[model samples]
Target: MNNADLRQVVHANSGTTCQELAEMFSVSHETIRLHLHQLGKTWKLSKWSHMN
Candidate 1:
């Protein structure tokens, strides 16, 4: 899946971490972080707070 798709999953499960997401998507942790950064711009403040 693309970053946007992965971001949606992350959004739905706010407590999940970048590493977890990367594992789930079979991507690198840095890849997850990049998507998270892009997603963060549009993500709700409440959601962003869940990042570790």
Candidate 2:
């Protein structure tokens, strides 16, 4: 899947980490962060939260 797909998955599943997602998507943690930024989003509170 693509970065956008991976981002959606992470967003859907709360409390998912950049490292974890990176490993799953075979990309660097920074790459995930970059995508999130491009999407105008980010994991809040330094930890993933279920609340949107």
Each prediction's TM-score against the native? Answer: 0.67, 0.69
List runs of model 2 lying over 4 Å from the truth: 46-52
Q: Which stretches of candidate 1 lie over 4 Å from their true place?
A: 41-52
Query: How well does model 1 score by local distance difference test?
Result: 0.68
Q: Please state every model's RMSD to the true fold in angstroms.
A: 4.8, 3.4
- Candidate 2, residues 1-52, lDDT tens digits: the string is 4756975786688578889888888999998877766666667876654334
Backbone Cα, N, C clashes tallied per candidate: 0, 0
lDDT of each: 0.68, 0.73
TM-score for candidate 2, please give it: 0.69
User: Distance (Å) between predicted and true CA of 6, model 2?
Assistant: 2.0
lDDT accuracy of residue 14 in candidate 1: 75
The stretch of ten residues in a row with the least summed lDDT in candidate 2 is: 43-52
